[model samples]
Target chain A: MRQPIAQGRTQKLDSKRHASAQEILDAAATAFSERGYAATSIDDVADVLGCTKGRIYHYFRTKGDLFIGIHLQALEWALEAVGPTAERADLGPEEKLREMVHRHAMHLMNRASYMGPAQYQIEMNLASEGRNKDEQMARILKMRRQFEAYYATVVEEGIAAGAFRGTDANILVKAVLGTINWMHVWFRPGGPQDSTVERERTAAELAEFAVRGVVA
Target chain B: MRQPIAQGRTQKLDSKRHASAQEILDAAATAFSERGYAATSIDDVADVLGCTKGRIYHYFRTKGDLFIGIHLQALEWALEAVGPTAERADLGPEEKLREMVHRHAMHLMNRASYMGPAQYQIEMNLASEGRNKDEQMARILKMRRQFEAYYATVVEEGIAAGAFRGTDANILVKAVLGTINWMHVWFRPGGPQDSTVERERTAAELAEFAVRGVVA
Candidate 1:
């Protein structure tokens, strides 16, 4: 009975540690997004986490490492949210595109803090005097290419299915993705309209425009 | 003779001061582009200018002010570069679009430092901070709307003249502009081909695509 109790306590401690790390990441994302990477400090993140800088150091070796980890995790979340919809073989290409747009926009609107930081770091911070700069950049570029390729595949399939035009798939993909990414820079959570309803409308309009451009 | 001499001296001093400010702005543009607004400091700008922080402060009030100035100046240059071509009444809509694309691409590629910072700041930083934030945003949105309105007008004219199909002009304008702005994010100067040549090809392709999409 004592052995079991000891094991349960260890499990609880592990869970607590995991939760702490997550809190730190959340805090870091907000700081990085608002103040930018260079201006934000470990202490700032720790303050938000209600912890000490040493706690952050225990989990993240360096600020650069933390930022890169944040970037990858954000991307992973985005992919998980949209990737499965894209992979549904039973859905038609148009439907897949629509679902992808809806999910992508919804994720961005709801998770703006997480998504916004990833964008700021990638667009503004990664190349600046960061640790493992080259490796980090390569990883980012690779992930971007993978994401683009995924979009291109969808466009290509749509074209083959007589739903999209035989236009250059690469350019079309870029246009669609660029419009979506640009949303992070401007999208607000709550203005006058419901965010979910507005996002759905925006996504639907964008998808329709894209389909029109690519469809024969 | 003394008056002329004094006037010349004053003129020379003013020119020298202007030259220094231009130099500092140029250096700051590069640093901001490579390091971003947050990671970069007045000292970094001064370092790039091969001067002291006092030199930077001599021309601009703060880093934020300097960044906003650079961003506005870059937009001014872009407007000057593409604005005339867009205003030409002799060219048809297709030709005008082609010219706008070529000039815009050339400007971005050649002035990547200034243009990149402006693009990044407009899309990300402005929304995140103070410093005439609302006014700057309104101005930017106005400029964008004007640009899109220009495209929409052309599309409307083309449709009226029976030169194009009846597509939603606003949506088409947004798609094209989104594609063009997206270039600033990913376009590199050169690889196996000259950047000028690539710009022309891209411009031509986009023009053709837009024309094909709308043309009757």
Candidate 2:
């Protein structure tokens, strides 16, 4: 934010601070994605931005704050990507679910650096302590549940529409989302032939395959 | 070990040394899975085993060494579970893949503590350094490739038999394995309802779903 910005700050100053916070988050996400949460530090995040740790501390009070910010933003990006498709009234249930999975797969890959840290950090540290982190983690967890809800809603619609297999909806949703969540394991950003067409094809094909799994 | 005793003594204490190493790995794995590699320490692993640090260092030289040991053991267990089905001559390509996936999923959940750390550590630090680590890393990499090759062979056969969707085998294999690999992300072992019946059902259902995606 230049979050938690104090009360006397002007609107224009707040915007500049917000941009700085965004910049720090971007750098922190990369560091966390590469080294993971336990290994990454505020200094490393600062180094990623070619700035001193003070610049990071100017917006983030601690490493956990940066992580919380990254997790929040990652979920927000994911919700933005798949939310509209999940709610589209014109599409049938199967079509809607397929599009949601497709957008999610694409989002996971396209913004992988952003999502990578969130995936690694959130899973292991649900019980992490500290007052600010507790609140932030709760918000992050709620947002994550909302993201899962989007998928759950579409999967339920498909089942009720008689297009999806009559299996446990929780299991079905997790299995479908697994195809999207496991991308960071094998994704390498600096391939010699990392073409957009290849990436898009892979995402689309994966979406199709995932949907076919639950199709009755 | 013929085995090397924990503290670098290369002795003929085969069975006991092996047993102790196994126990240490079991304990270390639980710690690593729960806390992640960077957050976990040798002390934490020792605490899990209810032993002192000396006991841990006696079998393995360092935490990295312990991680390497657990990873090798996990892959060994995985290969044991699925390797036979993948090579069985009586089964068709689709049945073979289904069985392999089933066994792998079951193994992952059954030996979750063993496999969870492997999933997290191997994916992040493929390029981790050290002489012992470098050599061990290569063997681990080779075993992983062998695991993938099992799926690749069955998938190619499925495609040739007109039993599987004729998509790229690499992407297909990764997607299918993703269903198995994502278990560590969501699996919670201490639930009151964590019965064998439920675990078997999940593994079976997930295998069915995964294989369905590839079925033509």
Candidate 3:
């Protein structure tokens, strides 16, 4: 966040403000999750951060912008979690899927805040329009398709290798991804029944279920 | 829609109007799925039905009531689909779970309109307040629990009979149900690549995967 000393204090302040975009996004994600995206506003996000709306606007132009940022971050996390497994040449399709599902389950379970808004991006897309809606939706979709394609590719490989039952790779991908994505909606941390370790065990079991679904 | 002749023509008209409640709910479900619950209104639902707002108002007291009614109806459909499988004494737990999941996936996929809104009841619950919110949410939660409890019972029975793997039954139930509930978001009928038979096969495969997850 440091600007060249010769440039002046004003530029340093601006850079510092820019660096706080993540903080704004984290606050916005929480607000959107607690209060549905349509009901939440810049004021609400600002209120949560103990800042003015202008502070939010410094980073995001609109509520849609914040939502898109949250989604992009979430997609990045999901891709980051599974991309390595998908790309590894040493792993077969079955192992690839197992690792991908395991990483994704952990990501979704651990980052519960971002998953809700990211999963509900369809509704968020509907709530905004004419303000880069086409570009934003297209980009989000591209990222989502990339994420889903990883699963589809692995499923196809599994089928070819005779490790998985032959089925429509696309639909099979959805079924497996759905189980992973739905983690945040139900799995709560520190519940009497759901200790931290129990959540980890459940994540492993979920991966097993998803992998087993396609595996012969 | 019949009324006694002695009650006159007015009574017949009232009965005819009363019978249209299901039509209103159906239209509302479609509108809600398309425009989302918060964006949809009585006028939107009526417009879809090619009727006036008065027609919708006569049947539903508010949009919340209509949303709740749609949720209840969807829940009823889901329960109806899986209830018989749960009750069958002839089938073992593994078979019961397989049949129940197969029936549920088909129900969710076939009733895509209702399932979208029903699965999104969390957002709907957030949108409305003070208008039977407690009663409606409680009833919805109760129905959902009953639905989940059915899965839990079968998982327990499966484990007891040494037919399935030992795991956290509650967590296993959530994982399976999440996959089933997520069907509507992605699966559609008669896509260029997806046929009716293909959809059925995917449903069966999902059941196979879910049942295999728990089975020893």
Candidate 4:
């Protein structure tokens, strides 16, 4: 009976620690999005969580570790949002494209915490690091290629199915992704329109343009 | 006779200073492009120039000032290449578009030193800084908007003359600019094929795609 109680306590403690780490990640994402990666510090993240830097250090070994972790989490969120939609075998090419576009735009506008930082890191930080920065960057680039490859597959399949024209799949994918990603540079949170509505409209327009551009 | 000698001496001095400043800016652009705005330092720029940090400080008041100067010079190079093409009223929309596309691609592929770093600063580092960063960003944004407006006018004229379709000029401009700007992210120097052939092919393909997309 005593052994069972000790095991239960340990499991509970482990779950609590996991939850704390997630909480810290959430706080870090918000801070990074608002303040940027360079301007933000571990202490700022801790302060936002009403915790101490020690707690962050307990979960993340270093500031770079925390940043890389945040980058990975954000990439995961983006992949989860669009990956499954693009991979659905039952949907026709056009339908799949529309759904993917909708989900991607919505994710960028609504989940700015994740997508915003991902964009910042990719567009800004990746090229700025030195030789010592290769390991972290290599991991990030691998994940990025995976993400881009998923889109490229969808584009190629669409063209093969006669849904899209015979333009270069690589270039078409880059164009589409560029339009989608560039939104982060210009998107404002609370301007004149509802964020969701604006994103939906923009996504629909871009999807229509891309589909028409590639259609037979 | 004294006045003539004094003028000659001043001209020689000015020419030497101009050459030195140009060399420093070139080195600074490479360092900032490779290491990024925040990660790069005056010492690094000086080392690249085979000089000391004091020499860089003599030319640039601060790192920020140097970055801003490099940014402006890069914009000037791009404008010099593409601006004149956009201003020609005699050419048809398709022809004009073709010229713009060709020149823009050539500029990017050849002048990667200036254009690459300029792109990095505009897309990433501008947002990474604080409120003080806004002035520089605003200048960049303004120039970008002007460039877009130039394309929009061409698009509108093309549509009016029955050479193009009446798509949303704003969206079309964004698509074109986005595609062009994204080249820096993936383009490499002497990686695979001849740069000129690759750029020409890309420009032709993109122009064909854009024309088809916008035609009624």
Task: Please tell me what DockQ candidate 2 reaches.
Answer: 0.57
Model 3: which residue pairs collide?
A: none
Query: What does the interface RMSD come to for each candidate?
Result: 3.6, 1.6, 2.3, 3.1
Candidate 4, residue B182: the lDDT equals: 65
Q: Which tens-of-lDDT digit does each residue in B1-216 have in candidate 4? A: 112111122245566766787788899888776666666778888899898987777766667667776777777677777789899988989788767866776777776667777764455455654567566667767876666667787778888888876756666666666667766666666777756777778766666555555656
lDDT per residue as tens, model 1, A44-126: 88888888888888877778777777777677778877888878899888778777766776777777777877764575666
Supply candidate 3's per-residue lDDT for B89.
Answer: 91
Q: Which stretches of candidate 1 lie over 4 Å from their true place?
A: A1-13, A46-55, A91-95, A130-141, A157-167, B1-16, B41-58, B81-106, B122-177, B206-216
Candidate 3 positional error at B3, Å: 20
Candidate 3 lDDT (Cα, 0 to 1):
0.77
Off by over 4 Å in 2: A1-13, A126-132, B1-13, B123-132
CA shift at A212, candidate 2, in angstroms? Answer: 0.7
What C-alpha lDDT, on a 0 to 100 scale, does residue A175 get in candidate 1? 60
Model 3, residue B131: distance off in Å is 6.4
Query: In angstroms, how far off is B23's CA in candidate 3?
Result: 1.4
Task: Return the DockQ of model 3.
Answer: 0.45
lDDT of 1 at B12: 55
Tell me the deviation in Å of residue A33 in model 3.
Answer: 1.4
Off by over 4 Å in 4: A1-19, A44-52, A120-139, B1-13, B120-141, B158-167
Question: What TM value does the first chain of each candidate achieve?
Answer: 0.81, 0.91, 0.86, 0.79
lDDT by residue (tens digit), candidate 3, A1-216: 322221121344556554587788889888877676766778988999999998776566666767778887888888898988898999988888888898888888777778877885465345535654666677778989999888988899889889888766766787798888777677654556656676678778888888777788
